[model samples]
Target chain A: MKEFKYVITDNEGIHARPAGELVKLAKTFASEVKVAKDGKEADCKKIFALMGLGVKKDQEVCFKVTGEDEDAACEALEQFMRENL
Target chain B: MKTYSGKSVYGGIAIGRIHVYKKNESMVRREKIDNPDAEMERYERAKAEAVAQLKGLYDKALKEVGEVNAAIFEIHQMMLEDDDYNESVENIVRTQHVNAEYAVASTGDNFAKIFAEMEDEYMRERAADVKDISERLLAVLGGGSAGAVQSQEPVIIAADDLAPSETVQLDKDKVLAFVTVHGSTNSHTAILAKTMGIPALIGTDVELEEIDGKFGIVDGLEGKFYVEPDEELLAQMREKQQAELAQKEMLQSLKGKENVTLDGRKVMLYANIGNVKDLPKVMQNDAGGIGLFRSEFLYLESDHFPTEEEQFQVYKTVAETMAGKRAIIRTLDIGADKKCDYFGLEAEENPALGYRGIRICLTRTDVFKTQLRALFRASAFGKLAIMYPMIISVDEIRRIQEIVAEVKAELTENGTPFGEPEQGIMIETPAAVMVSGELAKEVDFFSIGTNDLTQYTLAIDRQNPRLDEFYDPHHPAVLRMIAMVVENAHRENTWVGICGELGADTELTEEFLKMGVDELSVSPNYILPVRKRIRETNLEA
Candidate 1:
C-alpha cells in the first residue's frame, strides 16, 4: 500500500467534473484507490463519493492505493493532478 | 370559460385545443400486494423498463440536438437512480402490489407536485424536469415513441414550463405562440424563443385545458394572451402581424451592410457572447465585432479555473475568428448569484449587492491574475480589449490597472511575448456613472452594463418579484446615466459602447445614436434588426 498527499488545484476544487475525471482515472488501474480530505475518505472510483468530501481549491487531500499496481496508481494520480487539476 | 391577462412576451395568434399538461394521476393509484418477494421483483422490473425508456429518449435527444443538450437527460437518469425516486417507487410497488409503471408514475408525480409547490422559482422549475422524466417513462410503459409532438393544426403551446429541447421541436410556422403558467425571462425556453423569434407569454395563471382548441392571440412583447378574440381585435392583430413581417423583411435586407445612419453617421453593431459555442451564431449574423465576451463560461462546467492555455485557446479562437474586428472580453464577473463552488465564495444574503464583479477579482488576485495573463496572451492573436465589470469607483479602476501593470512586468521579466490590450471598465453601478468623467480619463474605453446600471439606479432588486415591475431600462434616470457615460467617454476621445438588452431595443437604437454612443452591443439575433434600425435613423446633427 502507498499513500501520497496533494492539494487540489482545479478552480472548482473536487466538484462534479473533477471528481468524475479522478474516478475515471482511478478505474483504469487494477489497484483500489481511496481519497480522503479532512478525515472524509471516499472511493476514488465513485464521483458522488469524491463530491461528498467537498474539497475546495488548494485544500490538501491524501490518496491511498492498495494492490499490485499501487506505486503506479499513486504516481499516475499525482501526475494527473499536477498536469490537469 | 376563464381568461387571465399577462404581458405578451412573444407574438403569434392561434386557435387550438389547450392540452393541459396535468400531473398524470393514474400513476398514483396504489395496488394491494400479497407477496413481498413478487412485489419487489415487479418493482425492479418496472424501474428497469422506465430506465431503458429514459435511455432511448436520451439517445433520440442526442441525435436531435447533440451531446451537450442530450447531457441534460443525464440529470433525469440520475433522478431515476436516486434513492428518493427509485426507493420510493420500490416501496410503493412492494407495499401496495402496484405495477411498476403505476408505482414509478405515482412516485414521479408526487415529486413533481412537491417541486411545483416550491416558492423558489429555480426549484419550482424543477417540476418541469420531473414532468419530463415522468412523461418519458409513461411513454415507454405505453409503448409509445419519444419525440412526439401533437399533430394538430395551429396550436398554442401552454405549459407550466417548456424545456429548451422541447421548445426546439416546436415548428414556428405551425405554432402560434407559447404561454407558460410559470417561467422567467432568463429561462432557457424564453431565451431560445427570443432567438427563434417566437412569441411567448410566461407567468400566466390561465389553465391550458380550459382553452384547448380556442382561438387566441399571444402578444409576446406585451406578455398578453387573448382567448376567443372578437372580429375587430383579430383584424387589428392581422394588420399588426403584416406590419411586423414587413419590418422583418426590411431588417433582413440590411444584412451584410454596415450600420450607417441616414445622414451617414456610422455605429458599430456587435454581439455580446458568453462562450465560443455562440461564435457560429455571431458569424451568421455578420456582427461588426464582439462587444461583450463574458469570460465566466470558462470557469463554469469545469473542475477548476481554466488554465492560461485553456483560456488562450478560447480567446484565441474568438479573436482570430473576428479577424481584426474588436472582441471586448469581460473578465470573470461572477459573484453570489453565479457562484462557483471551486472559488469557495461564501453564500451572501444579497449576492447582487455583495462581493461580485470587480470586488471578487480584486480580493482574489490569483484568480484575477490568471485571467489577465490569458487576456494579455490572447491580445496578440486579435483585436482584444479587457473590460472590467461592476466598477463603482476610480480606485477600483486604478487597482485593476496596477495589477495589469504588475502582470505585464512579470510577463516581460519572464520573456513571455504579449501585445498590449486596451483596458476598459463597465460603468454599471450608480457610483461608476457618477465618476465616469474621472474613469474616462483613465480607461481606453467604456461600455455601459445597463442591466446592472438600471437595477442600481432605481434601487430595485431585480431578482425580487415585488421590484420586477420597477426594473425598467427606459426609466429617465437610467437613460440619463447612459448619456452621462457616453458624453464623458467622448470628451476624453475614448469610444463608449452600450452592451445590455437596451442596446438591442429597436425603438431606442436611434436614441442611443443621438446620445453619442459609439456602439450598440446585443445578442446575435438582433444584429440585423439593430443594423437596419441604425441605417434608417438620422444621427448627424
Candidate 2:
C-alpha cells in the first residue's frame, strides 16, 4: 500500500475537470485508489465519488493506493494533482 | 376565418400553418412472461437506443444552445446508467417474471417517485426527466421514434402542453410560435416563447385540427389566433412581423460592446432568463451574466417535481457557462401570478398579494432546502448568487438564513461540493421599501423589482388593462422607494441592482444612475440602448 497527502491549491476546489483528470489517470494502473478528506474517504476511480468529497481550496486530501501497481499509481496521481489540480 | 382567444403570455405576431404536436405517451402495460432473461435483453436494447437518441440530442443542442443546455442530456444519460435506476429495472424484470414493459413501468414509477417525493420545486422536476427517458426507452421497445415531430415546414406548435425536454428539443427555425389548447400564462412553454421572443398563446379553446394545415395569424399582444385570415389581415401581420425582425436584427448588432456610459461610467447590464436554454440568447446579447434565473419554470415544466441532482446540473451548467459572471438564481416564486396545479393552492380573490414567493418557500421548508442544496452544489462551479423574492420583513430573511445554514451543514456533513455564495433579495414589496434600512442589513445586495413595487404600492392590478392609468411605474413614491433601497444597501456596504421593467426604461436610465444603482438588469433588447443612454448621461449633472 502507498499513501500521500496533498493540499488543494485551486480556489474553486476539486472541481469536475481536475477530479475527472485525476480519475482518468488513476484508472491507468491496476490498483485500488481511495481519496480521503477530513476523515471521509472516496474512491479515486469514480469521478462523482471524488467530486462528492468536495475537497475545497486550502484543504489537505490524502490518497491511498493498494494492489500490484500501487507505486506507479501513487507517482502518476501525484503528478496529475500537481500538474492539473 | 376563425379567431380564438386565450392569454397573452408573449406579445408578437406569427403567421404560419398549425402543426399539432402530439408527444409520446409511455405505453407501459404489465404482462406476464416466462422468459425473464429475454425481457432483460429487450430492456438492454431499449436502453442502448435511448442512449443513442440522447447522444444525438446532446450534439445538436450543443451546436445550437451551447454546452450548458446540452449538459442536461448528459445528466439524463448518467441517470440511465445510475446503479439504483438500472438495478431496479433489472430486479423487477428478473423477479416479477414479467415482460420488459411491465418491469420498466414499475421501475420508472419507483424511480420517479424518489424525485417526486423530494421537497424542492426545481429538484422535483427531475421526475419528468426520469419519466422522459423511460418513455423514450418504451418508445424504442414499442417500435416508434421519440419526439420526432413530423413538421413539413415552419409552423406554429399547437399542443395541449409542452414538457421542458420537449421545448428544448424543438428546432427553433421550424417552429414559428407556440399555440396551446391548454396551458397557463406562466406555463413552461409560454415562458420559453417569451424568452425566445417568439409569439405564443396559451389556453385557447379552438380545436387546431379543424383548421389544420391552414394559414393562421397569431396576435400575441391581443391574445388571439385567426385561422386562415383574409389578405388584408395577412398584410398587416406581415408588416408587423417585418418590423419585429428588423428590430431583432438591430439588437443583434449590439452583442459585442461594453455597457459603458459616454462619461466613462460602466455598469453591468444583464438579462433575466426563465431557464438554462435561454442562456444562448443571453450570451448573444452580450449580457454580463444572468441577473435572474426564474427557477419556477423548472417546476412548471414537469408533470411532477424535480430532484436535487437534476436542479444541481441546471444551476451548475448556467454558472459554468457564465464563466465567473454572476448568475443570480431566484428561488421558486410560484403561487401569485403563476398557477401550479401540483401546489393545490386555494384560489384567492387577490392571489397576487395573498401567498407567493418566499412565503410559499418558507412554509415549504423541504422545497426550500432542496433548492438551497442544489444552489450550493452549483456554487462550486462559478460565480453564483441566491436571491429571495417578495421579502417584506427581516424575519423572513432571518428564517431563510436559518434554512440556508441548515442546508450548508447538511452538505458539509455529506462531504458535498459547495461554496459560500453572495446572497441577495428582491425588494418588490412596499413594506420592504418602507423598512429598507432594516432589511438591507440582512443581505449582500438588493434588486428592486419595480413592477411589483409599483403594483403593490399603488394597489392596482397589473393584469387589468383598465388599471393602466393607475399602474404608475414612475410615480414619485416608487422612485422614492428605489432611492431609499439603494441608499440603505450602500450604507450597509452592499450593492443595489434594478431588475424590474423600469431598469430597462431609457427614460429612467439617468435617474437610476443618479439614484446610485449599482447594476441595471433588464430585458435583452434594452441592454444596448440603456448602455447608450448611460454613455450620454453625466451622473454629476
Candidate 3:
C-alpha cells in the first residue's frame, strides 16, 4: 500500500469543484484509493463519500492506494491537494 | 396603491403585468409494480433523460451566463451519474417493487439528507444540488414539463426563488423583469437579470395571489414594487420610463463622437471600473480610457493575499481588453472602510485617518513588491498607467520611486519584459495640493479624487450619515485647491484629470472645463451624458 498525508489549505474545505476534480483524478488510476480523516475512511473515487469527510482548512487527511498504479496515484493526488485543495 | 421594497439587482424602471411563476408539481406516489425488472428499466431510462436534460441546460447556461455559473449544470450531470445514488434507486425499485418516480424521490431524499447533515457549511449547501438533480429526475419520470413560464406577452416574473435551471429556461424576450421574495444579489436569477439587462428586485415580501396579472411597476432605483398604482403614480412612472428610454437613445447617438467643447477644446472622458466585468459597460459607453481601475477587489475577494501570477492575470486581462486605451490601475488601497482579515489590520478608533492606502503599501514592502511586479509585467500588454493613492508629501513619492527603480532592476535581472508605464499620484489631500508644484514634477500625471478631497477639506466623515448636510463638494476651498493643483501641474508640463463623484456632476462640467481640467473619469453609466454636456459647452463663451 502507498500512503501519504496532506493538509487542506483552501478556505472552503473540499468544495464541490475540487472534490469533483479529485474524484475524476482518482478514477483515472486503477488503484483502489481511499481518503481517511480521524480514523474514518471514504472511497476517493466517490464525490459524495470524499466530501462527506468534511476535511476543513488546516486539517490533515491521509490518502491510501493499493494496486499497480499506487505510486503514480499517490504522486498525482499529493500534487492535486497542494495545487487545488 | 400597495408598495413593496426589495434589493435592486440592476437599476432601471420596469412596468408590466405580473406573472407569478410556479414550479411544476411532482408529488410522487408509491405504486406497486408486478415486474421489478421493468421498473428498474424505467428508472434507468428516466435517469438517462435527466442527464440529457442537465447537459442541455449546461449548454444553455454556458451561452447565457459565463462558464463559472454554467459549471453548476456540469456538476449536476456528474451528481446524476454518481454510482451510489443510482444504485440506491435501482435497489429500491428492484427489492421494494415500487414505481420509478417513488424510488427516485426516496433516493433523492436519502442523499440530500446525507449532504444536509454534513459538518461543512459549503457541503450542507450541496443538499440543494441533490434536491435539484433529483427533482429533475422526478419530473422526467412523471412525464411533467420542468419549470415552464406560460405567458402570451412579456410580463414581470415574480417567484419565491428560482433555481439556476429554472432561471435559464426562462424565455428572455417574454420576461420583462424578475421580482423574487427570496434571493440574493449573487443568485443565478440576479446574474441572469443583469446579463439580460432587465430590472430585477429580490426579497420583496409580496403575496403572489394579490399581484398576479396586476399592472405593476418595478422601480429598481428605489427598490420599490408598486401594485395597482394610482393613476397619478402610473402617470409619473410612465413619464419617467419614457424619459429614460429617450435619454438612452440620445446617448447612443453620442457614440464615436469626440469629447470636445463647441470651441474645439478637447478633454479625455474615461470610466472608473472595479474589475474586468465592467469592461463591457466601459466599451458600450465609449470611454476614451480607463482612468481608475480599483485593485482592491483582488485582495478583498481572496482568503489569502493573491499571488503575483493571480494579480498579473487580472491586470493583463484589463490591459488586453482595453486594447491600447490608457488603463490606470491604482495599487492596493486596503484599510479604512475596506478591511481584509489576512492583512491583520487592527480595529482602529478612526480607520479613515489611520493606517490605510499608500501607508499600508509603504510599510509592507513585501506585499507592495509582489503587486508592483505583477503591474509592471502587465504594463507590457497595453497603455497601462500606475497611480498611488493617499499621498500627502514629496518624500513619500521619492520613496515609491526608489522602490519602483528596485523592482525594474530585479525584473531586468530576471530578463522579464515589462514596459515603462506612466506613474502618477492621486492629489486628494489638501497638503498635496498645497505643494502641487513639487509633487507634479515627480509624476507624469495628476488624477484629483474629488470625493476624498471634499471629505478631507471639509473635515467631514463621508461614511457618517449625520454629516450629509455639512459635507459639501462645492466648497470654494475645495475648488481653489483643484484650481491651484491644475495650475501647478500645468507649469510642470503634467496632465491633470478629475476622477470622482464630482466629475460626473453635470452642473460642474463646464466649471471643470473652464479650469482647464484635461480629463474627467466617471462611472460607465455617466460617460455619454458627461460627453454630451462637454460637447454643448463653448469654453470661450
Candidate 4:
C-alpha cells in the first residue's frame, strides 16, 4: 500500500469538479484508492463518497492506494491535488 | 365557479380548456407475488426503461437550463444505477415475497429516512432527489406515463408540483398555462413558464380531479385560477383573448421593420435574456440587440461559482451572435427573489432593499472581478456593454469604476484582448432616479427595471397578494420617475432605455417616445409588438 498526505489550500476545498476529476482518475487505475479526512474514510473511486466526505479548506486529507498500478495512482492523485484542490 | 389563489409566477391571461397532468397516482399495493424471480424481472425491465427516460430528460434539460441545472439528471441516473438501491429492491422482493411496486416504494421510503437524518441540511434536502428518482421508477413500473401527455387542443395544465423531467416533456403547442398547488416562484416549472411567456400560478390547493376537462382561466397577473366562470366573466375573458390574438397578429406583420416611429423617431427594441439558451428566441424575434443579459443566470445555474472561462464563453456567444449590436450584460443581480446557495448571502427581511446588486459587488470585489474579467475578455467578440443593477448613488458608481479599472489593468497585464465597451446602470430605485444626473455622468446609459421600481416607490411588495389592490404601474409617481430619469439622461448626453414590462405597454409607447426614450428592452414575445407600436407612434403628433 502507498500512503500520502496533502493539505487542501483552495477555500472551496475538494468541491464538485475536483472531486469528480479525482473519481474519474481513480477509476482509470486497477488499484484500489481511498481518501480520508479527520479519520472518516471514503472510497476515492466513488464520486458521491468523496463529495460526502466534505473535505473543507485548511484540512488535511490522506490517500491510500493498493494493488497493481498503485504508484501511478499515487503520482496522478498528487499532481491533481496540487493542480486542482 | 370555483376560484383558487396562488402566487402569480408569470403575468398574462390564459383562457383555455383544462389539460390536467396527473403526474403520479401513487397506487402502490402490497400484494404478494407468485414468484420473486418474475417480480425481479419486472423491476429490471422498469429500471431499464427508467434509465432511458432519464437520459432523454438529461439531454433536454441540458439544452433548456444549461449544464449545471442538468447535473441533477446525471446524479439521478447514477442513483438508478447504484448497487445499494437495486439491492434494496431485490432483497425486499426476495425476503418479503412482495410485489415489485411495494419493494420499490419501500426502498425509496427507507433511503429517504436515512438522508433526512443527515446532519447537513443540503444533504437532508437531497432526500427530495432520492424520492424524485424513486417516484420516476415506480411511475414507470406502475404503467404510469413517463410523460406521454397529449392534448389535442390548447389547454391550461393543472397539477401537483411538476418534476423537472415532466416539465421538459410538455408539448409547447398544447400547454397554455401551468397551475400547481405546491411550488415556489424559483421552481423549474415557474421559471420555464415565464421564459416561454406562458401564464402560471402556484401554491394553490385546487382539486384537479373535481375540475378535470372543465374550462378554466389562469389569471396569472391577478394570482388566481378560475374554473367554469359565469357568462359575464367569460365574456370579459373572451374580450381579453381577442385583444391578445389581435396584438399577436399585428406584431407578426412588423417582424422585419426597423422599430422606428411614423414621425421618423428611431428606437432600438431589444430582448432581455436570462441565459445563452435564450439567444435563439432572441434572434427569432429579430431583437435589434440584447439589452439586459441577466448575468446572474451563470451564478444561479451553477453548483459552484462559474469559472471565468465558463462565463466568458456565454458572453462571447451572445456578443458574437448580436454582431455589433449592443449586448448590455448586467452584472450579478442576485438576492431579493433570487438566491444562490453558493454565494452564502445572509438572509434579509427586505432583500429588495438589502445586500443585492451593487452592494454585494462592492463588498465582494473578488466575485465582482471574476465576472468583470470574463466580460472584458468577451468584449473582443462584438458590441459588448456592461451594466450594473440597483445603483443608488454616485459614490457607489465611483467605487464600481475603481474595481472595473483594476480588472482592466489585470486583463491588460495578462495580454487579454478586450474592447472598451459602454457601461450603464439599472434605474430601478427611487434614489437612482433622484441621482440619475450624477449617476449618468459616471456611465454611458440607463435601463430602468419598472417591476422593482414600482414596488420600491410604492412601498408595496407586489408579490404579497394583500398588496395587489395597491399595485398600480400606471400610478403618476412611476410615470414622473420615468420622465425624470429620461430628462436626466438626455441632459448628460447619455442614452437611456427601459427594460421593464412597462416598456411593452403599447398605450405608453408614444408617451415614452415623447420623453425621448432611446430604447425598450422586453421579453422576446414583446419584441415584435413593441416594434409595431414604435412603427405606429408619432412623437410630434
Candidate 5:
C-alpha cells in the first residue's frame, strides 16, 4: 500500500466535474484507490463519494492505494496534484 | 387573426408560418418477435446505437458551447447506460416477442412518466432528457435518422420552453427573436439570450403555432412584442433599431475611456456580478471593478457550507479577473426569501422583514468568519472589499469589524498567507441609513442596496403581489433615505456606490449624479448607457 497527503487546490474543491475526472483516472489503475478527510474514507472510483467528501480548496486530505499497481497509482495521483489538482 | 398578451421577457418582431414544436410524448408500441436470441441481439444493437447518438449530441454541444455546459449531456448518457432501463427493454423484447424499437419505446415511456411525476422541478425536467434518449434509441432501431434538430435560419423560434443546450444551438445571425410560453429571468436560456443580445419574449401564453413565422417588432427593453407590425410601426422600429446599433457602436468606442462627467469629475462604473460565469461579461463591458459580487451563489448551490479554501478560490478568480480593480464581495445573505433547506431557515410570515442579510451573518458567526477569512486570503491577488449586507446599526458594524480583526489575528498566528481587505457596510435598512455617518466613520465605504432599502423604508413586501404597487423604488421616502445615506457617506469622505436596480434607472441617473454618488454598479447591458448619461451631465453645476 502507498499513501500521500495533499491539499485540494481546485477552487471549486471536489465538485462534480473534478470528481468525475478523479474517478475516471482511478478506474485506469489496477489499485483500489480511496480518499480520506477528517477521518472519513470514500471510494475514489465513485463520483458521489468524492462529492460527499465536501473537500474545499486548501483542505488537506490523504489518498491511499493498495493493489498490484499501487506504486503507479500513487505516482499518477501525485502528478495530477502537481498539474491539475 | 387572434391575439393574446403576456409578459414579454425579451423583445423583437417576427413574421412567418407558425412552426409549433409540440412537446414530445413518450409512445409505447409492442410487436411479436419469433426468436428470443434475435430479440436479445436487437436490444444490444439498440443500446449501442443510442449510446453513439448520445455521444454525437454531446460532441456537437461541446463544439458549440464548451465543456462545462456540455457536461449536462452526461446525465442523459448515464440514463441510456442504466441497467434498469436496459433490463426492462430486454424483458419486453424477449417475453412479448416485440421489435427492438417498440420495446425501447415502451421502456422509455414508462420511465419518463415516472420522472414527470417527480416533485422536484430539476428532476421533473429530467423527463425530457429521458424522452430525448429514448427517441434516439427508437430512431436507431427503426433505421431512421437521429432526432436532432438541425441548426436552421429560423426568423423566430417559438416553443413552450427552451433548454439551455437547445438555446446554445440557435443561430444568432438568423434568429431575430424568440418566443416561449414559460421562463424566468434567472433561467440559463434567458441569460444566454441576453448575452447573445437577441430579442426574446418569454412567459407568453399566446399559442406559439399561431405566430411562429409572423413579421413583428419586439421591444425587449419595454417587454413588448408586436405581431405583424403595421408599416408605420415597422418604420419606427427600424429607426429605433438603427439608433440602438449606433449607440452600441458609440459605447464600443468609449470602451477604454474612463467614466467621467462632462465637468471632468470621475465616477467609477462597476459591474454587479453573481458568479464567476458573469466575470467575462463584466470584463467585456470594460467595467472598472465588481461593485457587488453576491457570494450567495457559491453557498446556495452547494449541498453543504463551502469551506474557507473553496471560498478563496472563487474570490481569487474574481480578484484576478479584476486585477487592480476592486471586487466588493457581499457575504452569504440568504434568509427567508432566498431559503436554503440545508441552513434550516424556516419560511417567515414576512420574509423581507424577518431575519436575513447581516442578521443571519451576525447570528451565524462561523459562516461569516469562514467567508471573511477567504476574502482576506483572496485580497492578496487583487483589490477586494468585504461589504456587509442588511446592516441595521453601528453595533452590527462594530461587531463584524471585531470578528474580522480576530480572523486576521488567527491567520497571522497560523502563518497563513492573507491580507486584510477593506471592510464596508451596505446601507439598506432604514436604521443603517440613519446611522450612515457613524457607520461610514467605522468602515471604508458605503454601498446603498436600494432594493432592500426601498422594501424596508416603505414597509411593503416587494415579493407580495398585493403590495407590488407600493414597492416602488421611486417613492419619495425611498429617495430621501438614499439621499441621506449618500450625503452622510460623502460627509465622512468615504466613497458610496449605488448597486441595486436603481443604479440602472436612466430616469434617476441624473438625480443620482446630482446626489454625488461616487460609483454606479449595474448590469453589463446598462454600463455604456449609464456612462453616456454621466458624460452628458454637468456634475459641477
Candidate 6:
C-alpha cells in the first residue's frame, strides 16, 4: 500500500470540474485508489463520492492506493495535487 | 391591460405572443419486474442514450456559448456515469425488483437531497444537476424527447420552471423572453437567459394555460407583464420596443470603438464590478478596464475574516483575468451601512458616519497589512491598482503609505515576489475635496466617489427616504467638488475618475469631459451607452 496527503489550495476546493478531472485520472490507473478526509473514505473512481467529501480550501485529504501499480498511482496523484489543486 | 408582476432577472422589453411551455412530466411508477437482468440492461441502455444526448448538447453549446458556459453539459455527462449514482439505481433494480425509471428517479432524489443539504452554496446548487440528469434518464427510458419549445416563431416562453437541459435545447433565435412561475435569480434558467441576453422574469403569478398564444408585452425593466393590452397600450409598447431595439443595435455598434469626443478628447471608459464573476460583462461591454472592484464581498461572503491566501487567490484571479487592463481594487470598505458581524462592529446611531472604509483598515493594521500583502502579491500577475475609500486628509494618505512600505519590506524579507501597484485614494469627503491638492501629491490618482461626497457635502442621510427629495446627486456643490478634485489631481500629475452613480448619468458625461476628467467608471451595462454619449460630445463646442 502507498499513501500521500495534499492540502487543497484551490479556492473552491474539489468542485465539479476538479472532481470530474480527478475521477478521470483515477480511472486511468489499475490501482485501487481511495480518498479520505477526516475519517470518511470514498472510492476515488466515483466522482460523486469524491465531491461528497466536501474537502474545502486549506483542508487536508489523504489518498491511498493499493495494487501492483500503487507506487506509480501515488506519485501521479501527488503531482496532480501539487500542480492542479 | 391586465398585468402581472415578478422579479426581473434581466432588463429589456419583449412584445410578442406567449408560448406556454408544458414539460411532459410522465410520472415514474414503481413496478415489480420478474426479469431483473432485463431491467438492469434497460437502465444501462438508457444511461448510454442520456450520455450521447448530453455529448451532442455539449458540442452544440460549445459552438454557441463557448466552453465555460457549455462545461455544465460535460459535467452532466460525467454525473450520469457516476459510480455511486449507477450503483444506487442498479441496487434498487435488483433488490426491490423495481423498473428502471423508478430506480433512477429514487436514486436521483436521494443524491439530490445530499447535495441540497451541503454547507456550500455552490455545492447546494448541484442538487439541481442531479435532478436534471435523472430527468434526462427518465425521458430516454420513456422513449420520449426532452421537453423543448416546438414554436417556429419568436415568442415569450412562460413555464412553471425550465431545467438547464430543456433551456439549452430551445432555439435561441425563437426565444424572445422567459417568464416563470417559479425560479430564483441564481437558477440555471436565469443564468442562461442572462447569458443569451433574453429578458426574463421569475416568480410570476400568471397562469400559463390561460395566457397561451396571447399577445403579451414583457417590460423586464419594470418587472411587469401586460396581457391582452388595449389598442393604445399596444401602440405605446410598440414604440417602446422599437426604441429598445434601436438602442441595443447602437450599443452593439459601439463595440471596439474609442471613448473619444467629436473634438478628439479621449477618456478611459471603465466598469465598476463588485465581484470577479462580473468580468465577462465587463469584456462584453468593451470597458477599457475595471475602475472599482469592490473587495468587501470577500469579507461579507465568509463566516470569518478571509485569510491572506484566500484574499490573495481572488486578487490574483482578477489581475490575471484582466490581463494588462488596469483593475482598481478598493481595499476593504466594510462597517457603516455594510456591517459584517465577523468584524465585531458595534451598532451606532449614525452608522453611515461611523467607523468605515479607511477608518476600519487603519485601526486594524493586522487586517490592513494582510490585505495589502495579498494585493501586492497579486499585482505580479497583471495591471492592478489599489484605491482607498473615504479619505478626509493628507495625514490619512501618509499613514497608508507608511503601512504600504512596511508591507513591501516584509514581502521582500520573506523572499516573496510582488509588483509595484499604483496606489490611489477616494476623494469622497468634503475634507478630502478641501485638501485635494495636498493629498493628490501623495497618491497616483483620485477617484471621486460622488455618492458619499454628495451625502457628506449636503449633510443628508441617503438611507433615509424622508430626505429623498433633498438627496440630489446633481446638486451643484457635488459637481463643483468633482471639478475641483480634477483640477487638484492634474496639478500633481494624478489622474482622476468618477466611480459613483453620477458617472453613468449621460447628462453629466459631457460636463465631466469638459472638466478634463481622465476616466469615468460605471456599471458594465452602462459602459456602451456612456461610450456613445462620449463619442457624440463636441468638447470644442
- TM-scores for all candidates: the values are 0.51, 0.55, 0.67, 0.58, 0.55, 0.71
* Share of true Cα-Cα contacts across chains kept by each model: 0.00, 0.00, 0.37, 0.00, 0.09, 0.51
Superior candidate under TM-score, 2 versus 4? 4
Residue-wise C-alpha lDDT for candidate 3, range B105-148, written one tens digit per residue: 89888988988998776677677778778888877877876776
Per-residue lDDT of model 2, residues A1-85, tens digit only: 9999998765456754556557667778889999999999987876545655667767999999999999988988886675335
Among incorrect, acceptable, medium and high, the docking class of model 2 is incorrect
lDDT of 2 by residue, B198-296 (tens): 778888877866877888888887889998899998898899888977876666566577776666677878888897767756765678877888999
Say which prediction, candidate 5 or candidate 6, comes out ahead on lDDT: 6
Residue B193 deviation, candidate 4, in Å?
Answer: 2.9
Where model 5 places Cα greater than 4 Å from the true spot, the runs are A1-4, A7-85, B1-244, B468-472
lDDT per residue as tens, model 4, B1-541: 9988988877678888987777553678899888999989999999999989888887876655444455567667766766667889999999999998899889888877766776655455556666778888888888877666677888898887776666766776788888888876655566556545567888987997888899998887788889999899989987887787687657657767788888888988899889877765675577888889999888888889887766776787677667677899999989866988988888889887788888888998988999998888788878999999988899988999899899999887966667788999999999999989888888899999999999999999877899888788899999999999999999999999999889989889889889889999999888987887788877778
How does model 4 do on interface RMSD, in angstroms? 5.2
Please write out the lDDT profile of model 5 over residues B28-85, one tens digit for every residue: 4566768978878876877777677557656765544334445556645656765567
- Give the distance in Å from residue B164's predicted Cα in candidate 4 to where it truly belongs: 1.3
Could you give the CAPRI-style class of model 3? acceptable
* Residues B449-522 of candidate 1: C-alpha lDDT, one tens digit per residue: 88888888898887779877666768999999888888888889889999988899998988888898998899
- Candidate 2 vs candidate 4: which has greater lDDT? 4
Per-prediction DockQ comes to 0.15, 0.04, 0.37, 0.16, 0.11, 0.44
Worst lDDT run of 10 residues, candidate 4 chain B, spans B62-71
Per-prediction interface RMSD? 7.2, 8.8, 3.1, 5.2, 7.0, 2.2
Error of 3 at A50 (Å): 3.4
Q: DockQ rank, highest first?
A: 6, 3, 4, 1, 5, 2
Clashes of each: 26, 11, 0, 0, 19, 0
Give the Å shift of residue B462 in candidate 4: 26
Docking quality class, candidate 4: incorrect
